[model samples]
Target: MPPASLPPLPLSTAAGYQARHLLVLPGDVLVDEVETLAVSRFAGARWDVVPAGVEPATVAPRTAAPGEPGVLRTSRHTTLTGPFAPGPGLPPGSAMVFDVVTPRERGEAAFPGSGDRDGLGRAFPAGLPEKEERRAVDWLVEAARRLGGSIAVDVPSSGAPGIVLTPDPGVAVDMTLYSDVWLEPDAAQAVLGQVDGRIRLAMDGVDWQGPPAGIADKPLYRGEQMDPAVRKQIHAAADDVDIAALTSGEPLDGYGLLLDLGVDGMIAVEIGDEPDLPFLLRGLPWAAGGAVSYRVRWEPDDLAASQDEFPPMEYTVARKRSAGIVAALAKALHGAVGGEIADEAGFLVEPDDL
Candidate 1:
């Protein structure tokens, strides 16, 4: 049979243009295999495929899936199968797959009822849990090794707490903050309050209605409506406070502090509307040399339109920015940490040398 064409959907659209890697959720291999072959044959693009399964630690040892032929190997990719369980509450069946592609590849349409309904207003289709997603991510990382491609995982900032997998010394792993979860004023304040005594606060681009003391010297780095004066105030506040640490919502301009800024800890905030923020946060501390943690909060919304719009406009904007930051951070940090591994990958060698 001939390979299938890219699906008609947002993921497919993004994958077709922007994706450097393709991740296929478990139980969806049929779709992925068909699409991958089609893309390779028709589009003249080669995609690396990785199978998904539960880790041995999590699931009891079991045979590979039926007709899969245990651990198929090829020059382009490797495929493995096992009794891998999906995260909690995932439908009875779930698996993971990886398809490494370039920006030129297109994506297929969302599975029927598998995505949020258009105009539904913040309504999302039911999905699997975190562990399930993590399994997919882990598979991608492993796949990177066989395919000689860099691996990056998108996670949330608040949920940034997990055991780090030390990849091959030279191999670079990217940890990005997923920014779909909104931090409401109260929630943000509470997080700030938690670190009030432990660390001083400051702001870079945001404004305060009153004295800096009102914000407890906590820096609101790179936020909405932030200005130069606000940044100055944050700097001044940093000097006054003990300056236990520094964090930014995103990498700053003229902010060489990240490399030389001496502090007990440093955190890069990943804000987004996606639920993946926590995963990213958990994975970052390992990528960067530091002891780090994340806090998540969201604003309450009361919209009487469709069930889809409840997340509020402010939350949506924040989420978009958050996702962008996470994507940027993943690329940057991956280069910083995994440049050597990427070099060994060979495909990225020219880019690195340049």
Candidate 2:
């Protein structure tokens, strides 16, 4: 959907602070259907019905008041023409739109307390609390079961980038903060073994290879196996603790690795960290002090032209395979190293949630 048609959700109206999510359906859905879904999904919760295009602020503060029952205004749009047309990567067709508005102070059920913190007590500044975002995403996913479409986080005014949630199952995976702590080579290898075993068992046709072709010959960016500059910076920033001696040998046997899951995807596991001190981990409250900071990325294999034309089912299969491997790798690392993980979309990913 175009930004122009996507009205920015008001941060604060007379109704107090609020948040909204957009659900785009493949076909027109009746307002009654939307109402039923809302009622069923949020049973016993108060709901205030409003006409289409009604600003949330104009509504009374009954739902917005502290400790009062939360209010949700569901607005339906049947005519998805012009700027409201469905964009690429979304289901193509005439679309139906629904805007679901909720109060911002929904507490831990919707968001985390203060700055985003994990079970390990790591806290970091996040624009939209990852916990709340995950809760909203759960609703969108539920909506998709009945509505058959896509969802987007409508935050055009916040200066943050727009986030779209879809089941496109695209051929890419970028998991950040996969591990908050680094393990010794032996422990790292054990984690790798667990991840490798899990991936192989979960995905039927996965093939593992040592590094990508020519990576060994290339000038290493983050380390020489280790970088003197990075070592000095780490030592200085980390109260003179020798993180290098702590990490010792390469993680997962080698810094470079690959997973080929047939023609659908080719995922590269790049293991390393920032050359210099990362701003997020520089000072106090630096939770990921021992982080190895690896990244898992994927792309279509050499037969890109052929794979690009594959059907939706193929794409979804590829996505599932790649996503599963990334999840397994992350879960294993978290279990071994003790830290949090984030998904491609930058939301905190709990290992148990996998």
Candidate 3:
């Protein structure tokens, strides 16, 4: 059992202040996977939708159902999960949430915390004692290696040790080792020459909690007004899913931060959902919902004979963009038939279009 000092949700609500660091996972993975990973080795690790009234935590291991509104009561943290839209029961505040991701979650360490300097509404919290720093990094690196997908991490301010693993395999310049700790010449070469080139060195307390950079250059515009930062983040996340679905053919995973800025209502997209990436650009009928939507459906009509090199096959394609305030302008301008042609259908919106 954790010490009595760690307050539960109800009590914390009354106090009116909640602090926590959100460890957002890769969208492709299931929430259950995150829960399972927490119990496998990192016991204090947990996820929540965050509460309102101004916000979200850990305990016995349990999982919340998709879109369910409730609290997970365990030995460690009392986590409240939900859509949190300030509905009938879900008021408007913010979820006071955190995960037991470090040694401190188990009562093993501590560190100094600080706010973001980039003018973004995020924080770079401190934790992980000297004895456990390397071990934590190693564990995180190993997890990244196993996941084999795009991932990133944030470290505390004060130049403490922290790293985020990305998929690009490019050695970024200005990588930080620790407080005033830059990679040595030999170490830098060795690091770059080594195996997977996905590791990213982070410093000054920043979280790699969004999509991989340049996942897609397309822009998505929403009519609903929101903070520019939040708008940009969600657009990037949508591009991530858009590329994944079109190329890799993966279903929409979902989008949102483990913790939100609490500055505006969330505008998110989820897999197995409507107003999704597919119907929007695929020229398929989109189910009406408050959210911007999309869909697509196609079948191989007939194979065309190619005289020279290309694949000896051809089929028709159709595409379109959403008409919402934050809709995508069909970039695949096939006669502007909503970005569709006789055999090909699609479009691309630049990042700046938003």
Candidate 4:
């Protein structure tokens, strides 16, 4: 079946604050199937429609009939949106909300812990216990496959922005890598060489350089002075102490490198093994167990034009380039040290997976 399309829904400030996921079904599905799906997953669970003005928390959930729309309360905090009309198109579809919040507060009081002050804390948040989030992701992936569709995340700020579960590989640039053994600076440099080679094979005559000489003299708009200085610092420190600080987290020590991809952007590579893997990359058993890993990221140049919201052509192109680059790097790393590559959505990346 062709891929289902999800029109960007208006972002609800209240519900949208937490990372939100939606399941987009490509074709029409009978309400019976939806019920069956819920039962299969939740085991004899019942769904009910909270009357027009009544709150979900206030009412007891009576069994919903086959064609009736309702809410499937999986737990006290999580609820999956019930069935809605599947619209028309060659790849016609409708989205079911997978919310990780209480129905009564509608996610207002969900996962409130945060030690991050002044934007310095772990990149991996303490929000929603990993166990709970994992349960949610597992169900979402299962639901998408059950419906012959894909999983999508509407939150752009998510670590895995523009993530969709599709067979035909598409670029999702933001990626993380977990390795069983520590890969040192020398090994990392070798991996960088491999990545550079792959990119050159794909794009002819692309420039490869570090922060240029006299970068300070160059205008910011020229994009000549582009350098991931912070990443470079992390890399130097990693060489000394071999631990890297996570986003918003304290800098201990770690190994990393930054390669300027010119127009595509700068790639930041950081290595650390102390912390558990980011939630987005823990789908696999071994990865979930945790190991030394590299967080490969693409930082777009500031001058790049903002992608148009409607068409998203520019954005698509940028992601393709960046994602392709990181994919190349992942393949190279896999070849070098024998590790797994995972995208932002935490799925193990196959060669065909972008």
Give the number of the best model, judged by lDDT: 4
Model 3 residue 35 CA deviation (Å) reads 3.3
Decide which is better by lDDT, 2 or 4. Answer: 4
- Expressed as tens digits, the lDDT of each residue in 239-306 for candidate 1 is 55533333334442111111111221232332223322222232354434322112221211322211
Residue-by-residue lDDT tens digits, candidate 3, 4-55 = 1222222112111222222223334333433333334443444433222211
RMSD of each: 20.6, 16.5, 27.4, 15.6
Off by over 4 Å in 3: 1-22, 42-129, 132-134, 148-164, 167-354
RMSD after Cα superposition, model 2: 16.5
**2 Cα displacement, candidate 2 (Å):** 27
Best by TM-score: 4
Estimated TM-score for each candidate: 0.21, 0.38, 0.21, 0.45
lDDT of each: 0.30, 0.46, 0.27, 0.50
> In candidate 3, what residue range of length 10 has the lowest lDDT sum?
171-180
lDDT of 4 at 130: 46
lDDT pick, better of 1 and 3: 1
How many residue pairs of model 3 clash at the backbone?
A: 36
Residue pair clashes in candidate 4: 120-248, 121-248, 121-249, 238-254, 243-253, 243-254, 244-253, 244-254, 280-346
Per-residue lDDT of 110 in model 2: 19
